[model samples]
Target chain A: MNVTVKTFAQLREITQEGCFTLTLPESAVTMGDVITLLKSRSDKWSQALGASAGSENGSVLMARNQQLCDIQTHVQPGDELAFFPPVTGG
Target chain B: MFALIGDADFDQQWLYNRLRQEASQKAKGNVGAIVTFTGLVRDNNADGNILGIELEHYPGMTEQALTNLVQEAITRFSLTSAGAVHRVGRLYNDEQIVWVGTAAPHRAAAFEGANFLMDMLKQSVPLWKKEFTRDNSRWVEVKASDDKAALAWLREK
Candidate 1:
């Protein structure tokens, strides 16, 4: 299955790419799996998406198909996933 | 009238006029109060003078979130109408960053509704801000005060 992954704001700065496609195995059914896969690609990916260092300031926010979700949230093929920093605009 | 505008300046007066027109149409002259709030980009943050700031948002989600917030404010406060406009992309200091307007039968409802919109917007919206200083730039950290304000609304219920 292929999923479209997006990074924004500071995460984008760290990742150096705003959007990309990731191929996942059938066993990888959740956002956590996607994070784990991306984190393994490189230290930068780990630093940006890792659960511990998530971002410089705080935990990264995740959205599946533009709706806010958690790592445990189930994902499917062709889903759009986003990771970004905490919101500050008003 | 909820929108996530990019780099384009918005007219607060137009939003106010629209709210007034909507109030008159929806309530038949019953609305007695209309309130609006505008957020400006400050020239400085805790670090010192800021040259400007860049705002980024998740495109599709941002629009849906603002629309949902406006609808929620209207339903919760029994407002006649409400609108919110947020700016994205590079913005200079003192520029208008956001605007929110609400109309209701009384002053209290209108005031509370506008307040609710801003408080909720800070916490729930997907937009992020980055401050650019003369020598450096950094992402604005989420303030605990903002969380407290947003939570106060929930506690009020």
Candidate 2:
């Protein structure tokens, strides 16, 4: 399965990569699994995605198919997943 | 409901008239009030010595989210029409950043609808603002005050 992953704002700066594709294994069930996978890939990704800062669960916001979702949300094969910081615009 | 996500400054008179026209066409001059709010780029934030700001947004996601907000405002406040226009890209101080307007048969709903749109927009919209000073730039973090404002609306329902 494949997923389109995107990062924005400070999250993009931390990841050093804005958008990309991720190939997920059959074992992957939810968005949290994908984040865990990315965190395991490299040090930069781990640090940027909030995994290392101990703010991974709450501070970071996630969206599936462009709508806000929880990490526990189920994933389809080609879902678009985005990670971003809390919004600050009016 | 209407929403526009662009870099150009929006015309306030046009928005008001458009909303009024839409509502009148729907139900013969029933719109009694139209509340409009415009957010401008101030010269200062927490750091006093600010130059300008740059706004970033999720192109497709932003439009969808804003459209949903406009629709929600119209329904939640019993508004006849609702709309918003958010500016993006590099903006200088004293420039317009955003606009939200709501129309209803009464003044109370119009005012409340506009307020709800703004409060929700500050937190839920996928828009990020970066402040620029003489030395450097930094992303503006979400404020607890904004969350409180939006939460108040939700709890009332």
Candidate 3:
């Protein structure tokens, strides 16, 4: 299966890529699995996706198809997953 | 609820006329009062020396949030019409940044409805502001005072 992944703010800056097309194995089926999979890809991703840093959740927020979702949400082949920092708006 | 997020400066009269037109059309003899609130960019935040600010938002999520907020206002206040617009990008001092307008059968509802829209948008909308001063820039944090203001409204209901 294939998916397009996106990251924003520090994640994007760390990854050096905003979004990209990628191929995923059939065994990887959910968002959590994808995060783990991405972590396996590089140390940079691992740090950026880490559970917490200095008490915050690594300052990354994930969205599947533009809706905020947890890591366990099921992933489809053509899904667009975006990762960004927590919103700071009024 | 209507929201415009971009690099453009919104037309103030255009929005006002648009909201009035929407209220008039939706009224169809039902609405008896319309109230609107507009917030402008000021030179100061809680901290001094805010030269200007930039607004950033999640494109799709921001719209969804605003829609949900407006729907809530309509239901809560029995509103016939409601609209809100928040400008994005670089905004100068004293420039209009946001407007929330509501129409209802009575003055209290209209007033409360408009207030509700602004209050809800401030808390729920996935938008962030960065304030720039003469020497530095910093992200604006959600103040406890804002939360208190929003909470006060709930007590009224």
Candidate 4:
């Protein structure tokens, strides 16, 4: 399956890629799987998507099909996934 | 009504008047109060004096999230009307960054409606802010106080 991944704000700055298409195997069916694949691509990817340096909280936020979701959420073919920082707008 | 504007300033008076007009028409002129809030970019943060800031948002999700917020406020507070406009992209200090207006038959509802809108907006909106100072720039961290404020509403129920 092909999923479109989007990174925003500091995540975008760190990864240096705004949007891209990722090819995932049928076994990689969850957002966690997607993160696992991306984190292995490079050190920048790992730092951007991995848990915070010294904190338990995940450094990045995730969304599936534009709605906020967690790593356990399922992802299907053609889904749009987004990764960003915690919201800070008023 | 809700909008995600970019690189442009919105007319506060225009939105206020529009809300009043719509609320009066919808509620048969029973609207007794209209409340509005405008957020401006401060010139400084804890790091130092902020030269400016840039805002980014997930395009489709941003609109949906803001609209949901306004609708939730209307239902929760019995507001006749509610609207919000947020600016994105590059913005200078002291500039208007956001505007929210609410109208109701009483002052209390209007006041609380606008407050609820702002509180919820801070927590759920997908927009992110990056502040630029003289020597460095950093993404604004989410405030625990904001989460507390939003949760306070849930506890009220």
Evaluated with DockQ, which candidate comes out highest?
2
Q: What share of the true interface contacts does each candidate keep?
A: 0.68, 0.67, 0.38, 0.67
Per-residue accuracy of model 3 over B85-146 as CA lDDT, tens digit each: 77777787888788788878889999998877776778666676778898987777665455
Highest TM-score model number: 2
What TM-score does each of the candidates earn? 0.91, 0.92, 0.77, 0.91
| Predicted candidate 2 versus true structure: per-residue lDDT over A34-74, tens digit per residue | 88998987787888776432233356777789887766779
Give candidate 1's chain B TM-score: 0.89
| lDDT for each residue of candidate 4 in B1-157, tens digit (9 for 90 to 100) | 5455556899898988888888877997698899999999999998678988888988888888788788889998999999999999989999999999998999999999989888788887888899988788888988655544433432232
Candidate 2, B148: how far from true, in Å? 9.2
Candidate 1 overall Cα lDDT vs. reference? 0.82
Off by over 4 Å in 2: A51-57, B144-157
Tell me the docking grade of candidate 1. acceptable
Tens digit of lDDT per residue, candidate 1, span A1-90? 998999899889888879999899888998888888888977878888766532223457777897776667799889999887768888
DockQ score for model 2: 0.53
Better of 2 and 4 by TM-score: 2
Clashing residue pairs in candidate 1 (N, C-alpha, C atoms within 3 angstroms):
none
Q: Measured against the native two-chain assembly using Cα atoms, what DockQ does each of the candidate structures obtain, in the order listed?
A: 0.48, 0.53, 0.25, 0.50
